[model samples]
Target: MTRGVRGATTVENNEAGEIIEHTRTLVLEMAEKNNIKPEDVSHAFISVTKDVDAAFPAKALREINGWKYVPVMCMQEIAVPGSLPKCIRIMMVVNTDKQQTEVEHTFQREAVKLRPDLLEDVQKDQQK
Candidate 1:
């Protein structure tokens, strides 16, 4: 079955370096948590909040050794009042044997507030 793994993270600043670094962190964590292989990823849809215009989160995927060939599209997130700032979100579509409930969704940094229910899972992974 094909499943989508969702992840979101917040950058400390709007600088390109910060954006890239946080995006990489979020993607790597999602991959590790879900046992996602680059080859199994059909596409990645990345979106950043309006305040984050310094870099494209999708560009950071290219820095990963095997992810160069994976298709990625970057977009601007809909601006909502009181929403997290400098947040980068990704939806990675992967072909996997795992069922929907088996898929792990990651949220880190300030973006963790976006999905409190996943907090325990994220904390457990970090302890390992």
Candidate 2:
């Protein structure tokens, strides 16, 4: 089955370096948690809040050893009042045997508050 793995992370600053580093961290964590291989990834869609204009988060994945051929797209997230700032989110679709509920969705830094339910699931998996 094909499943989507979602993740979000907050950058400390609007600098390109910070955005890239944080995005890389988030992607690596998602891949690790879900056992996602580059060959199995269909595509990666990345979105950043309006405040984050330093760089496209997808570009950061180019530096990853096996992501050179994976298709990636970047977009601006809808601006919502009181939403998290400097946030980058990614939705990656991959072909895997795991069911939707088994996929790991990660939220790092202040972004963790965005999905408390998923956080709980991750914690449960760790306790197993």
Best by lDDT: 2
lDDT of 1 by residue, 1-128 (tens): 89999999998888999999888988899999899989999999999999899888887899998999999999999999988988899999999999886788999898989988777765675788
Tens-digit lDDT string for candidate 2 (8-95): 9998889998999999999999999889989999999999999899888887888999999999999999999999988999999999
Highest TM-score scorer? 2
Which residue ranges in model 2 land beyond 4 Å of their true spot? Answer: none
Ten contiguous residues minimizing lDDT sum, candidate 1:
117-126
- How close to the true structure is residue 61 of candidate 2, measured as C-alpha lDDT? 87
lDDT on C-alpha atoms for all candidate structures? 0.90, 0.92
How close is every model to the real structure, measured as TM-score? 0.91, 0.96
Model 2: pairs clashing at backbone N, Cα or C within 3 Å: none
